[model samples]
Target chain A: MTETRISRRFAECAAAGRPALVTFVTAGDPDLETSFEILKALPKAGADVVELGMPFSDPMADGPAIQAAGQRALHGGQTLAKTLDMVRRFREIDAATPIVLMGYYNPIYVFGSERFVVAAKAAGVDGLIIVDLPPEADDELCLPALAAGLNFIRLATPTTDDARLPAVLANTSGFVYYVSITGITGSATPNATRVAEAVGRIKRHTALPVAVGFGVRDAATAAAIGRDADGVVVGSALVAAIAASLDADGRATAKTVPAVAALVGDLASGVRTARVGAR
Target chain B: MNTTPNSLRNGPDDRGFFGIYGGRFVAETLMPLILELEQAYEDARNDPSFKAELANLSTHYAGRPSALYYAERLTEWCREKTGGKFGAEIWFKREELNHTGSHKINNCLGQILLARRMGKTRIIAETGAGQHGVASATVSARFGLPCMVYMGAVDVERQKPNVFRMKLLGAEVTPVTSGAGTLKDAMNEALRDWVTNVENTYYLIGTAAGPHPYPAMVRDFQSVIGTETKEQFFAAKGRLPDAIVACIGGGSNAIGLFHPFLDDPSVAICGVEAGGHGIDVENGHAASMTGGRPGVLHGNRTYLLQDGDGQILEGHSISAGLDYPGVGPEHSWLRDTGRVTYVPATDKEALDAFQICSRLEGIIPALEPSHALAQVLKMAPTMDKSKSIVMCLSGRGDKDVFSVAGHLGETM
Candidate 1:
């Protein structure tokens, strides 16, 4: 397979002798304009790769924080077309940072999977992480996406046993996202020891880089998890930051973008120092 | 309609697609557990002892083989409406007479037994109007296991009696307040619970929906309704009825009654959807097949009420039980294949049928099945007098009397 932006970014991070800091923020959150500012500021604040959440009305896999972010975005009239446009705008300024669109499959299915891939590739999306479409339903979007040159990133959870690991990794590209916990996002604290073991186990199965996410909040946890994994992903915490900085009316205030950027800077510093004193 | 050589009963191919409708569309964390459930269910299906235990429970515990009664008064009223020119003889598969006052108990019993066989200790379920919640709590109590039922807060307030019934049965009722606080929201909360507690929890889905094994498995368990209806209708009328009708929420009762008659070319199958006001009213009905299109939600690709962005829309219905955005994937497949006809019954029509049936036949039907009864009232008057129709009285109205009274402007 040819190397894409995601692969090249991971390679760059590895060459720097540190894990990458992956930050997730819902697109069009608080409003389309503020969300774009946050997206553009992520890489500068040390987010190596960005996961843009396409807010859906029902985000079953999401916990309370991300769910609220999605609702806020939708209440502000965020549509799939608008989300894609936000990506297009983000790509205009930044061409180096890899961007992955993460959400459920229905919106993409409604958008026409073939059309979505073409449009997504044109809009500068590097990969996808559709939580609901497992390996069993690969024909729905995974293959078409791979054929269109967009990386199809797959999530490996704690419940994915060794027997089922191969199928989950069969068509996966970009990087393998190892969910640190068995529950929904931001529900539980992932034990660093177990996450490292899981990352090692996944590494034994494939040559792709492994990124650990779910329940990652502070820089300490990020650094702990980044010690063994190739990348550290933080989503619910960043979304929670946006929620906290919002005004009483739930509209975006002056602090929303800077609040998320500050958190991302801290998490990036954590990842940069993850391997400094350990080995 | 010519009967094809192929059997309609056989479906949900090896990968669980009922002709591009049903597939396992869940998170990877739940994938292994679902596969485990499929295997355990397959093993139990082939084991004779499993069938024997389920049969025993159905016969003695759930009061199975619920009577198939001829609605003579209802039929006479239809004849009066048509001025004796046309009226099909009407019969009812009395599932409301079952233990929990609905066909929900039949599926509950089968699933609970399977849960025990799989060594699952905790039980979780999602309910709309609490009929399924009551049934799930009943089985959990009978088996000495703890149960948790997720219900929309709106339904909790509206269906107070059934909520109390569930509480009395030692079940925890969690009121979900998100997304209009209705059935779809309750289902989303239940999925969250299942994902969080996959180690020992068994999600006893109330309807014939959800992902792969669930749609097919729930249908197999509920198929007992059709299997019994076939024999009883044959015994009472000496042949099959001209048609059969049932209401569709998640389509459990309808599929239960229609599965056995799928290949019976002589028996026409019709499903009634809950049209809150009318199909044309914006976001005012739960008629997925009538006013919606196919989209993925709640782990299955089915007909759903979604917006232009594929965001699921909150559906409205006077009967809280029928308020859901999506229909079962099997029903979607059936609709596509033209194996069954689907129609909509407005809340006004259902309310009218509820009162007419209560006064004439002395059987107060639940609002869910009243939709089916409304469709029956419309169709019976149009058919020839010699023809016959059987409708599944899926639930009793004792639980709905309070809501019905409020709707009728009565203080009670």
Candidate 2:
């Protein structure tokens, strides 16, 4: 496989002796225009990689923060096409920042898998993180997305045992998302000691970079996790920041983009200095 | 054109797919647990001790082999409506007479036993109309395990009596207020709970839906309804009934009754979906097969009521039990393969049947199965008296009497 933008960015971050700061935001959140502003500002705000959430009506695995963000985006008339359009527009200004579209499978299934892959590739999407499609459902969307030359990143949860880690990692690319906690997003706080041990175990099996997410909230937690992980994914916290900055009617205020950007900037600094004076 | 499969019962192949419908479409955190469940269920299926224990509970605890009643008065009423030119004999698989007053206990007992076998100490379930909640609570109480039931807030108000019954049985009922505050939301909450409490908790799904093994496992446990009906009807008439009908809410009772007779080409099967006002009304009915298309939700790819963006639409129905946006995955495959016919019955028609069956047979039917009774009322009068139709009386009307009275504008 050719070296994609995601792998290249991870390598660059590794060369700097720091983990990559992976930031997530729901596309078209609050409204379409404001979401685009947030997406465009993420790179400058120190986001090494971006995960754009494709809003779906029923996000079973998500907690309240991300779920409400998706609802707001959907309420703003965001569709899979519009989400891709946001990515396409983002690519116009910044071609080096890797963007991954993350959500459940139904939206893509409804968009027609073959058609979605072509459209997503054309939109300059670097990877995908479909929460519901496991390795058992490889033929459904995973294989097709890979065939279209898009990285299909698979999640390796704490529950993924030694026997099962191989299957989860087989077709995975870009990076292995190690869910630090065994719960939904923004729920329980993960133990840093356990997370480091898991990252080491996964690294022993493959040469791929491992990113830890789920329950990562602030700069302190990001630094604690990023010390061992190749990438630190902070999603619910950023979406929560967006929620906190919204108006009472749930409309986006002037501070929405700034709030999210400030949080990402803090998390990015923490991730950059995580390996400092250690090793 | 769909070719008929040689055997309809052999489905959900090794990977838990009924054709291309069912699979483990879940989070990576839940994948290993689902695979463990699949293996555990397989072992229990082949173990005679497990079979014997379930059979014992079915007979002694749940009161299995619920009567196959001849519904003579209902049959006569239909004949009178048709001037004796039609009206086939009407029979009912009296599942409402079970211990928990519904067919839900059959599957609950089996699942609870499996939970115990898996050393899971905590039990959780999601319910729409509370029949499954009551059944889950009853089984949890029986096994001395802590139980939690997630119900939609709307259903909580409508199904007050059942809510109280679950509480009386020592189970915690959490009303989910998300989405439309209905079954789908409750299911989403339950999935979240299971994902959060993965270690010692077992999600006892209430229907033949959800991911791979659940659809197949629930179907197997509930299959006793059809197995008993087949034998009883054979003994009563020395042959099988010509037709069978049941309401579809995640299609548990319907699949249970339909699975045992799928190979019998001589018998016809029909599933009735809840049409709140009518299917033509947007988002006004729960007829996933009739008005919806294939989409993945609640862990399986099936026919779902969704919009152009693949966002699931909240389905409406007078009966809370039937108010889910998606049907079971096996039903989706069956609909695609033409093995069974799916039809919709509006609220008005079901209400009319609800009153008619109550007056004629003195049996007030639950609104869920009243939809099925509505279809039987339609099909029975068009057939000859020599033929017979069996409908699953899946639940009693006691739980729905309050809602029925309110709908009828009568103060209770």
Candidate 1 is scored at a TM of: 0.99
lDDT of 1 at B249: 96
Off by over 4 Å in 1: B1-5
lDDT of 2 at B142: 98
Tens digits of per-residue lDDT for model 2, B249-316: 89999999999998899899999999888999999999999999999999999999999999999989
Worst 10-residue lDDT window, candidate 2 chain A? A270-279
Please list the C-alpha lDDT of all candidates, in the order they appear: 0.94, 0.95
Candidate 1 per-residue lDDT, tens place, A26-49, comes to 988989999999999999999999
What are the root-mean-square deviations of the candidates from the true structure over C-alphas?
A: 1.5, 1.9
Q: Name the runs in model 2 displaced over 4 angstroms.
A: B1-5
Docking class of predicted structure 1: high
User: lDDT tens string, model 2, A227-276?
Assistant: 99999999999999999999899999989999998999999889978888
For each prediction in turn, the share of the native Cα contacts (below 8 Å between chains A and B) that it retains comes to 0.82, 0.91
Q: Score candidate 2 by DockQ.
A: 0.90
Tens digits of lDDT, candidate 1, B253-358: 9999999899989999999999998999999999999999999999999999999999999999999989999999999999999999999999999999999999
State the displacement of the C-alpha of residue B95, model 2, in Å, after optimal TM-score superposition: 0.3
